[model samples]
Target: ILHVTLTERRKEYEKAKERDAELRNLRDTAKLQEFFLQEIQLGELWLARGEHKKSIEHLTNAIAVCTDPNKLIEVLEDTLPPHVFEMLVHSIPYTLQV
Candidate 1:
């Protein structure tokens, strides 16, 4: 079920990218959101696959683009197990503290 949801989100991300290109002159939050969503989805997928390093990479990317750390934390809490979230926090300690 999660895989299916992720796949659907991936499709939405692709479409969003196309729309972003077409509306390049416009300043929109959708682009950032799409990138964030994609990164988070990839991070979760890697986590589920036991690829902690790759998961951290994608999660870091997501964090880099995020405007709200608290919101990101909320999403992470909902999506990732507590231990995995702790690992991610430790991996990017400085970034999270910022």
Candidate 2:
């Protein structure tokens, strides 16, 4: 379900002008808030594109910079699929572990 949707959207986004613009705009922004959302969106894009490592990189960065728990939760919920979500869910504790 979500697999097909994200992959298809990835393809469409690859051809989308707005997607590129958003990517570029977000990357250029220096503010943490702006960068975090852009990074999350970019992570989704990368994940959809089957670039898991890149996706993780951006998603991790997003998680690090997020000041609002609600917004962070929203991105976590919306960006990840079952398998990816499961992996991330397990990794959360380790990520936070000192």
Best by lDDT: 1
Tell me which residue pairs clash in candidate 1: none
Instruction: Superpose all Cα atoms of candidate 1 onto the true structure and report the RMSD in Å to 1 decimal.
Output: 16.5
Q: Which ten residues in a row are the worst by lDDT in model 2? A: 89-98
Residue-level error in angstroms, candidate 2, position 29: 11
Off by over 4 Å in 2: 1-30, 93-98
Task: Tell me, by TM-score, which candidate is best.
Answer: 1
Per-candidate clashes come to 0, 0
Alpha-carbon local distance difference test for all models: 0.83, 0.73
TM-score of each: 0.58, 0.52
Task: Please estimate how well model 2 matches the true structure, expressed as its whole-model Cα lDDT.
Answer: 0.73
Estimate the lDDT of model 1: 0.83
Residue-wise lDDT of candidate 2 within 1-98, one digit each (tens)? 99999999988977797778988887666576788779888988989998877777677677766677547756677757866766655555554553
Q: What TM-score should be assigned to candidate 2? A: 0.52
